[model samples]
Each structure stands twice: as structure tokens, then as C-alpha cells.
Target chain A: MSEIINVSAIAKVEKEKIRKRIESFRSNGKATPTLATVLVGEDPGSVYYMDMQKKVLESLGGTMLKLTLTEDVSEQELLSTIGDLNNDDKVHGIMILFPLPKHIDEHKVAMKISPSKDIDGVNPMNIGLLASTSGGIAPCTPSSVVEILKDTLGELKGKHAVIIGRSNIVGKPLIQLLLREHMTVTVCHSRTRDLKEVARSGEVLISAMGRPKMITEEYVGDGAVVIDVGTSELDGKITGDCDLESVMKKASLVTKVPGGVGTLTTTILMRTLVDLYEKSES
Target chain B: MSEIINVSAIAKVEKEKIRKRIESFRSNGKATPTLATVLVGEDPGSVYYMDMQKKVLESLGGTMLKLTLTEDVSEQELLSTIGDLNNDDKVHGIMILFPLPKHIDEHKVAMKISPSKDIDGVNPMNIGLLASTSGGIAPCTPSSVVEILKDTLGELKGKHAVIIGRSNIVGKPLIQLLLREHMTVTVCHSRTRDLKEVARSGEVLISAMGRPKMITEEYVGDGAVVIDVGTSELDGKITGDCDLESVMKKASLVTKVPGGVGTLTTTILMRTLVDLYEKSES
Candidate 1:
């Protein structure tokens, strides 16, 4: 018989610790950690995410500064605004909301922000840090995924983790992080010949292919821990890459769609802000 | 049964093409390739390598400029020398030989070279380029390994490769390169448990650990393509990480100790210099 690992319980414990840390920092005379959210266009999902993030930070005794720019803003203007925030001591961390206007070079805008103030860790400097294995800020989504896994699995030293999806966001960075933790990681993408065979090799499975219920019972072995980082709207509701009904039976632990990684992501953003604030003082 | 793949014949054909390319560039006036080698001490192995590299470059019509610094050159002096090389218009690429005197900070010195002239690809800027997936130059040894794999396998998408050893020079950079090629890469180190099991899982096995003949027949899967990147002196003779006798039996394709990656590394270095030279002119 395999023991069932409760992912929600682990996430709760992490969230509680983060909440207490924020409170302690607030009480200590340190400036309340602030995250500046910059949006280039009218993205409904981005707006909703910003609002939810603002509420979460507020709950944790942190503050959010929103900067909305029109879609017509020139590239130079956007860069200038980012440069200003970089120089401002008040802004502890900066996250430029994605889905920018088609005309703008997103990579240029990302490079404009100082790496020290980059809460999203999408900047080239932080990416280099992750690749170099020297340790610095890491991409938030993948970093959070590892944190969740570590909290549940303890040390990941010898574990075999197979990742579905080879996007720069999740698969690439996650491979590097897992390597740092000494886990043997395999990444499969759309080009993979045998997806189920690859998934069955994993003691830990991470699905980030953005497909609704892509991972079925065939992809999972008994006692496997599955982390679904995909969120797709199906039938007017949120669904994940893993088929919960079938995968849950085979998985020792599993993360649900709306309640799983999405919740931890914003919490990680708050933590990034706090980390930046502390580094500034030190 | 899985189909057996023969890699050595393909590698030889590719090697011949690469050799011809080097020869054509050497005789042609269009690309004047040059590599500058900087050596600080008088180590016997380093001297032999430096001499052999010079001969190889000259044979390929590339010029090699040797700069021998004193054993006790100050950090400032070393920096200034590298600065001169950075500013030299004739020098297309610069490489600081390994095992500098104990007084100098190797990382600081490596960082000082202009990224465009960093033929070795150890500079932070080039590292950043590789990390960002923007296709920048890479360290010669790992770069050669990837080139060999791709030349033999023909686009290594979704291939499972496991690399032993986590040295900055090989393991980390190789992961970045393999990820770029869309191969799922796993890196294992001294701390890794069940090392043989990990090595056996790889369809492509890269042994970079310095221990001579460390990878045995048991660590290799049938028909696995093996690349031995280690060069160690065992009983006054050069030996590799893979046990040639046993590994050759299990491996459908294998690179021997002296004739394997070592032969290709300096050739790759010359190729990198030619690339930098062309980029500079453009």
C-alpha cells in the first residue's frame, strides 16, 4: 500500500509561513514590500489576475502599485517607464503583465527592468543565473512548482521527474532547478514519440502542456505524484492537463486545477517582493 | 527490438565536411580567422595542449598568437592585458589557458574579455545568450558534444540524454545546449544515488566525470551512443571516462579517449573563432 501525500496541506503550511513572515516584516519598521504591476494593454485575464494579486498582497500586509499603459504606447515610452521604476527606491519588485501589444518587443521590455527588481524572473540575468547553477532569482512558476514538490517529497536527490512541455517558461527552467536538487529529469514535448511511456518513468510528473486533461490514467503509474501546471477553460469551467477522475486513482498526490498551482503562483510573487526588499537593505 | 543506430560513420562524414570548411576558410581571403592563446604558467600538459592547438590551427590556415604571462602577474596587470586583446582589431578571439597562477581570479579575468571576442564562450554575456535561448556561442567541449550528437542523430528532438558530472565547464553548459536542441537532459553528480541506474536510462550517455574509465558496461544500455569527455592520466597514459573494452561491446557508437572529444575540442575552438571573426566584420 502506498501512502497518499496531501498537496493542499503542504501548500497551506507554506502559505501560513509566508503570511507570518510578511506580518513580522511589517511590525519591524521595514517599509511594506511593494510590487509594481505594469500592464501594456487591456487583457481581461491580466486585469483579473492583478486584482486578485492585489487582494492577496493586502491580506499579507504588502502593497500593490498598478500602472496601466495604453496599447499605443511607444516602445521607448514603455522602456522609459520601466527605467524610472528601476531607479525608484520605493518599488521593491516589478512584474510586467504579459500579452503585450503586438508591436512591442517583449524581450526588450523585459530586459529594461533591473534583474534585482524583476519579481517574475523572466529577465535574461536571472535566467542566466538559473542556468549557471550559481543561484539567484528563478522563474516564479517553475520555482514555485519545485517548492511545492519539495515540501511534499522532502529531498528530491535521486527522484526521476518527467516533464511534459518544453516551453522556456516551465520545462527548461524546471529541468535546471531539478538538476540543482540532484533529480534526474526528462522533458517531453509535442515532438515526443511515446508520451505515456515517458510519463510512466517518472516518480514525479509535471504537466505544463496547456491541454485540458491531457494526462490520463495510462500516463501515470501507482504512487506517482502529479503536478498539473496547465489551466484550460472547458465547458465554461477550469480544467487541468490531468484527468482528475482517472489520474487521482493512480497518483499518490495530485493538484487540482483552480486550487493548485494558480494559488501558489501569486504567493510566490509576494515572496519575491519580500526577497527583493530584504536584499536591498542587506 | 529497438533499431541499432550507427553514429561513428555519420560523425566521420560530418568531421570531413567540418575539416574542409576550415581548410576553405584558411585559403580564402574572405575570412581571416585568428585565435589568441594566453598562458600564465609552464605546466607540461598545458604546454603540450597549447603547442598541439597551434599546430592544428596553422594546418587549418588559422593563425595562433601566443601570449605567455609571468607566473606572478598581478590581477590588474592580467586585466589590462586582456583589455589590450579586447581592443586589438586583428585578434578575432581570445582564450585564456586553464590553471592560471593561484593569485589571479579566473572568473574575473574571464569576465573581462569582450563577449564578442570570448571564443571560449565562458563570458557572462554569452552565457546569458545561451540561457535565454537566443543562440549564442558556447564552451567548445560541450558545444562539440552537441554538434556530434546532432550530426549523428539528425535533430535530437525528444531524445533522452543523461550527463554524468556537474562541472560548470561541461555539465551545466551541456544541459543548456541539449535543451536548445529539444532533447530531454538529466545531469547527475557525485551526490547522485544509483548512478549506474541513472546512466543506463540514457539513450545518449555523456561521461564527463574526471575519473578514468568510470562508466562500465553495466552503466550503458544496449546500443546506447556513448561520448566520453574525460581525459585523465592513468599510469602515465591518457585514458577516458568510459571503459573502452566493455563500453564498445554495449555501445553501438562510441568515442575513444584521445581520438574522441579531445580531437574535436580545439577544432571547435577554431570554428568559434571563425564565427566571431565573421560576426565582427558584419
Candidate 2:
């Protein structure tokens, strides 16, 4: 039986530490560490994510400010709201929930947020900083994967990490993070030829392709560490990028979809809020 | 004999096209495309690069503004200089010559250059923009590699490209460029295990690690296209990252050190200047 990497349990422990730290800061009369989220056109996924973030933050004595906007909100209006949050002394970190309606320019909206306050790492400076290995705050989903791997396998050095996505959000940033850990990283995307052959070669494989059950037994090498970063809905059931049943047989360790990386992201989001807050203080 | 990729000849062809375009614009009484360069503590290498840039720009009827500073220039002084250039209407592009004295923070210096005028693509925004594959304008050296390969191979789609350096200036940005071309890219560095094996895997191999003759015949696969992005002084002679004499025997197509990627860079710089100029106009 494969060792199912307990992502939530690990996140729970980390959350406990954050809770104590937040309390310490609060008792010492420091401004409460706050995460302000801007949501445009309510998405079930986005709502769930925000709910998770709010729960994770408030439970640790941190504050969550959720500003839900209509789908038809003009780009100027959204940018104005973000501008306000950028200057707000009480807002330590700001997250813009994505897919901000077709008419709105998402990249422009992302860039408008100050890099220091961008806990989601949406700002180009944040991604560039991550690429250049200059700063700490990385995009949450990628960081969640890193945290999970760090918990399960102490040191990632020399491991061949093959990521099955080339997204700005996950695969690209994850390469930088894994490279920092001294691991050999390879990124495979939609155009990658002989995908299964490439997938089987990874000592540590991460799938973030956002396809349901795309990775089967053939993709997992014997005793390889597998991380699924993809989440989707199939027939009203949650599905990940990998086939958990088949992957479970050959994988030495694997992260299930809902219970794994998905759970850790909101927790990492909370940690990022605290980090951004502490960074502002320092 | 290996097929020698003539980077200089190709650049000349591209330059001619740019020259005609510039001439047409000049005939219409448009402002001459201008490039402003910031040089600190003039190194011999940097001097040569500047000279080449000047020649390239003028040959195409563009103007070059060269500002030389002393070694002990304060960071504030440099920032002030960049600020002036950023606001200069005549300056369409700015290139900060390498090694900005020991005092000035390089990243800070890079960020100071306005992205619109940053022809070198050193700003985090430019790098971020390149990585996100939104709009073009990549860092010159990396873009030069893509141009050479695109010219030689016609299409990089589905080709396996392996980069031998992880520098922010080279390997990281190159990944985005190649990925944009739909090529499968794998990056290897000093810590990479089975170095020879990794290099051998590249159908299109790029050596940018700045090591002289490090990639021997053992590193070159059967009929691989080798791109050497390294330059070093070995025995009072210019040498590239790969063992040219040896790799030439194995590589189906190869780029020579002096006449290879280096020659194309100045032309690319010129293109970037014109690009920034045109971007401003549009």
C-alpha cells in the first residue's frame, strides 16, 4: 500500500504554530494580520477557496475582509477597490480571486496590487522575484506542493522533479521552488511529446494539468513520489489529475486530490498573510 | 563536417530589413529611434559591447546615447540617472552595461529602468511578462538563442531543448521562449546529476553555463544541434561553453563561439530598441 501523504494533518500542525504567533502579535498590541480578498463573479471554486481562507485566517486570530463584486464590475471599479486595499493600513495581504469576468483585464488587475501586499503572488514582481530567487512569497498552490513534499520527504535535493503543467500559477513557479531545493526539475506541458515516457522518468512527479484522471498506473514509476495538483468535477464527483486507485498501487507515496494539495493551499494562504504582515513590520 | 550556423549572416539579413523599415520612417520625418545606455566602471568587455551596439544602431540610422559613470557612483546617483532616462522622451530604450560597480544593487538597478524603455528586458515586469507569455520582448541573449534556432530549424515545436544554465539572465527566460515555440525544455545545472546524460538528451542543446569547453563530444547526442552560449579566455583565446572541436564532429549543426550567439546579440539589442520605439508609437 502506498503511503498517502497526510497534507491536512501537516497543514494543521503548521496552522497551530501560526495561531500561536498571531496570538502573540495580537497580545503585544500589533495590528491584527489581515487578508483582504477581492472576488469578481462568484465561482463555487472561488467561494470555497475564500471560505477556506477565511476559516484558516480567523481561526488563527487573523482577520479576513471579503469584497464580493458583481460579474459586470468595470475594470476601473475593481482597480479602484484594489488601490484602496493597497493603501489600507489594516490589510496586510491581498488576494484577487481569478477569472475576473471576460471584459476585465486580469493581468492589469493583478499588477495593480502592490507586490508587498500580494500574498497570492499575482503581481509580476512577485513571479519575477520567485524566478530570480530573490524573494520568499511564491504563489500558494505551488508553495503548497513544496510544503507537502518538505513534510513527507525532508530534503528534495538531487531528486528529479517532473511537473506535468507549464502554467504561470503552478508549473513555472514550482520549477523555481524545486530548483531552490537543489532538485533537478523538468516541466512538461500540453505539447510535450511522448508524455507517458516522460512522466514515468520522474523520481518525483507532479501533475497540475487540470485534467481529470489523466495520470494512470502507466505514468507512475515504481516507488516514485506522486503529487497531483489538478482538481476538477466529474459527474458531480471531485477528481484529480491522477487515477488514485492505479497510482496508489505503484506509488511509494501519493497525495489524493481533495484531501491533499487542495487542503494545504488555504493553510499556506494563511501563513503567507502572516509572512507578509511580518515582512511589513520588519 | 558539422553544419555551422551563421548567426552573423542571419543577423545581417534581419538588420537589413530593420534598416529599410527605419529608412521608410525616417523618410517620412519620424523621430530617429533612440537608445540610451548606462555604463559604470568601464570594463574592456563592456566597452566592446557598447561599441558594437552603437555601430549596429547607427548603421540602421538610429541614435545612441552613451552615459559613462565612475566606479564609485552611489546607488542613489545611479537611480537618479535611470529616473532621468525613464522620463526622457527621446530615449525609447535603456541598456545598463553589465557590472554596475560593487556598490549598486543590480536587481534594484534593473527595476529602476522603466519597462517600456528597458530594451534589455532586465526589469522584473519584462521577465514576468516573458514568463507569462503575454507579449514578446525577452532578454537579448536568451532571445538571440531562440532567433538562431528558429532561423536554423524553422520550427522548434516538439523539439527537446535542454539548457545547461539556470541563471535568471539565461536558462530561466529561455525556458519561456522555447516553451512559447512549443518546444519541450529541460534545464540542467552544476548540481544536476548525470550531467552528460542530460546534455545528451537535448535534440537542441544549449550550453550557457559559462564554462569553457565543458560540453565535450560525450555530451552531444547523435546529430544534435548545439548552441554554445558561453565565452571564456582559455590560453589567451576565446572559447565557448562546449568543446567546439569535439562537439562539431558529433553535432549535425553547431554554432561557433565568436561568430555564433554573441554576434546576434547586438542586432537583437537594436531590434529591441526599435521594438520599444514602435511599441510606444502603437
Candidate 3:
């Protein structure tokens, strides 16, 4: 049987490190690492992500300021709210939950977030910095994937990594990170022909497509490292992109959903918050 | 014989369109579209590029402002010059020639150019915007590749494109552009194992790694559309990454050095200048 990677244990260790850092900040008479989350309209997914962020930040002895707005919040009002957050010294990091009311322009909102405070890496400057291998932080989900891969496989140089998504949040940033690590990266999406053939080429395969249990045994190459980043609710259960049971039989190692990437994602978010806080101080 | 794309003819046609636009602007009593270029030190290649830019802009009835600084120019001094250009009412666009001395930080220089006037798309904000498929402009080289591909193959959807470089200026941005066009992209670089095998997989192959004629006929798949973006001097003659004479025999369509992507690249730069000028007015 292939080893099922325990991501929760990894997250737990990361949380302990965050807790220690926060404690040190408190002892040193420094302000708590505070994250300001701006949420508009109650899209369940966005709301859920915000709550997870809050729980993780607060649990680490950090502060989370939730600025909840009505679904009909005007673009001006949203921008002004973010402008206020940008000026607020107490807020070290800022994250704006997406899918704001259709009338509001998401791109404009993304730009309004100050780069230093954009812990989620939504700001265009931050995204560009990541792309250029310059000074920008990356979004949490992609960062978690890199962290997991590095932790499992120490030397990634010359390794072939196939990422099965091309999203700005996950797939795109993951490509840059892997390339920086000296690995060959192939990005596949819905339009990709021979998806299974291409997917089988990766020594390390990452699935971020939101399809549940789509990547089955045939997609798995013998002894390949599989990472599942998709989360979808099916029959009152959380399912990942990979059919874990079938994949485990052929894979050397795999990360399960709900407890795998998700657990580590929140931890990375907290880490970014602390890092932003430290940067702000320096 | 494989079809050699007439990039010079295409550039001429585009230049005519630009000339007409400038005439229209002149007829309407508008200021001439002007581009400000910053060049530090006497790097022959950078100087040659600036001269080419000047020649092209002038040919299109546009103004080209050259800002020359010594090799020992400080970071603050260079940024101040950009700031002055940013405030100049006559300057519609800005381009900074790279390799800005070891002492001066290039990334900081990139960030200093205002996004609206960053015609070359050197600003991190623009880079990020392009990556996110948002409102940012792309650099000329990558844009030229897209133009050539779209011109050759009407619909790029489902095409397998393999880019053989990972530079922020070319390979990285090109991935986003191709992905936006619904093509599957695989990026292979120095650390990519089985480089030739990976390169042979592209239905459309693009080489931007400045190694002189490293990609031979073996790297070309049957009837592939090959694009050579690399230009390196070998024995006093400029050469490209692909062994063009051999690749031309195998590729159904190919772009040659000196007269291929480079010609279109300069034309696109002038196009971006006029675009920025129009954008500034609106």
C-alpha cells in the first residue's frame, strides 16, 4: 500500500511555530499580527474561507478584523473600505474574499489592496512580483502545494511536475514556484487534449480542477506523487479531485482532501500574516 | 519547402495602420504619441535596441525621447529621471533598457515606471495584470509570438505549445497568453530532463533560450510550427536557438532569425506606444 501523507500533522507543526512567533511578538511588546478580511455578499465558499482564516489567525493568538458588507455594497463603498484598511496601521495584512456582487469589478478591488498588506497576493503588483521572481508574496493555496512538495521530495531539480489547472490563485502561481525550484512544469486544463496521457507524464501530479474523483487509476503513473487540491461537496461529504482509493494502490504517495491541502492552506495563510506583520515593522 | 512567414511584410502593414492613426491624431489637433526610453550605460545591445525603436517610431510619425545616463548613475537618480518623465505631459509611454549596471537595482527601476506609461510592460503591475488575465499589457516579444501564431493558425484552441525558456519577459508571460487562447502549454528550461523529447512534443514550438542553434532537426516534430525567438552572436553572425536551416526542412511553418520575431517585436512596441497614448487621452 502506498503511504497516505498526513497533512494535518504538518499543519499542526506549522501552527505550533506560528503560536511561538506570536508569543514572542507579545513578549517583545510588539503588536499582534493582525489580518483584516473584507467580505462582500455572502457567497458560501468565500464566507467559509474567511471563517477558516479567522479561526486560524485567532487560534495563533493573532487578531482578525472582519469587515462584512451588505450584498449591495457599491463599488465606491468597497473601495473606500479598502482604502481605510490600507491606512490602518493596526491591520498588518489584508485579504479580500472574491465573487463580490456582479455589479462590482473584482479586478479594481484587487488593485486597491496595498501591496504590503495584500497577504493573499491578490494585488497585481504582488502577482507580477511572483511572476518575475521578485519581491511579491504568493496566494496561500499554491504556496501550500510548493511547501508540501518540498517537504516530501527534498530535491525537486530536474523533476517533471504536471499541474492540472491554470487558475490565477493556484495553478499559475504553482507553475512559477516549481520553475523556480528548477523543475519542469506542464500546465493542463479543460482544453488540454490527451489529458490522461499528459497527466501520466508527471513524476509529481497536482490536481486543482474542481471535478470530484475525476482523476482515477488510469491517470496515475506508477510511483507518482499525487496532490489533490480540489474540494467539492458530494452526498454530504467532501471529495477531492482524485479518486483516492484507486489512486493509492498505484501511487507512491498521495495527499487526501479535506485534511490534506486545505489544512495546510490555512497554516500557510497564517504564516503569510506573520511575515507581513514582520515586514511592516521593519 | 516549408512556408517561411513574412514577418517584415506583416510589420509593414501594421506600420501603415499606425501611420494612419497618427495622421488621424494630427488631423484632430492631438499631441504626437511620444515614447520616452531610459538607457543606462553604453551596452551595445541596449543602444542598438534603442536606435531601432527610434527608427521605427520616427517612421510611424511618432516622437521618441531618449534619456541617456552614465553607467555609474545611482538608483535614486535613475528613478528620479523616470519620475520626471512620468510627469511630462508630452511623454505617453516609457521603456527602460535593462542591465542597468550592477549597483542599481533593475526590479526597483521596473517598479518606478508608472503602469499607464509602461509601454514595454516592464512594470510588475502590468506583468501581474497579464498573468491574471486582467487589464495589464504584455511585453512586445511575447505579444509578437501570439500575433504570429494567430496569423498562421486561426484558432489556437487545443494546440499543444511547448515554450523552451522561462524568462519573465518571454516564456512566463507567453504561457498566460497561450492559456488565455485555450492552448495547452508546457514550459521546459535548463533543468528540464529529456529536453529534446519534451521539445518534440509541441504542435507549435517556441524557443527563446539564447543558445546558438542548440535545437536541431531532431527537436522538431513532423510539420510543426516552429518559432525562433533566440538571437545570439556566433562567429560574428547572429544565430537563433533553433538550427533554422534544419528546422525549416521539418517544420510546416517557421520564423527565421533577424527578420522573424524581432521585426514584429519592434512593430508591436510602436503599436503599444500609440495604444498608451490613446489610453491616456481616454
Candidate that scores best on DockQ = 3
Tens-digit lDDT string for candidate 3 (A46-100): 8988998888889899999999999998999999999999999999998888878
Ranked by TM-score, top first:
2, 3, 1
Write out fnat for all predictions, comma-separated.
Answer: 0.42, 0.53, 0.91
> What DockQ, on C-alphas, does every prediction get?
0.50, 0.70, 0.85
Across residues A1-282, which tens digit of lDDT does each residue of candidate 2 receive?
798898889989989989998999988999999999988987988998888888878888999999999998999999999999999989999999997799998889988999999998878878877887568468889999999998888988877888999988899889889989888888888988888877887889999998999899899888999999998899898889999999988899999978989888888888888889999998
lDDT of 3 by residue, B42-151 (tens): 99999999999999999899999998999988899999999999999899999999878999988888888999999878889998988886578889999999999998
* DockQ, structure candidate 1: 0.50
Local accuracy by lDDT, each model: 0.82, 0.88, 0.91
Span of 10 residues, lowest total lDDT, candidate 1 chain A: A1-10
Tens digits of lDDT, candidate 1, A99-135:
7998999889877889889888777667766677465
Model 2 chain A worst lDDT window (10 residues) = A128-137
lDDT score, residue B174, model 2? Answer: 92
Better of 2 and 3 by TM-score: 2
The alpha-carbon deviation from the true structure for residue A17 of candidate 2, after best TM-score superposition, in angstroms, is: 1.8
Top TM-score model = 2
Candidate 1 all-Cα RMSD: 3.2
Which candidate gets the maximum lDDT versus the true structure?
A: 3
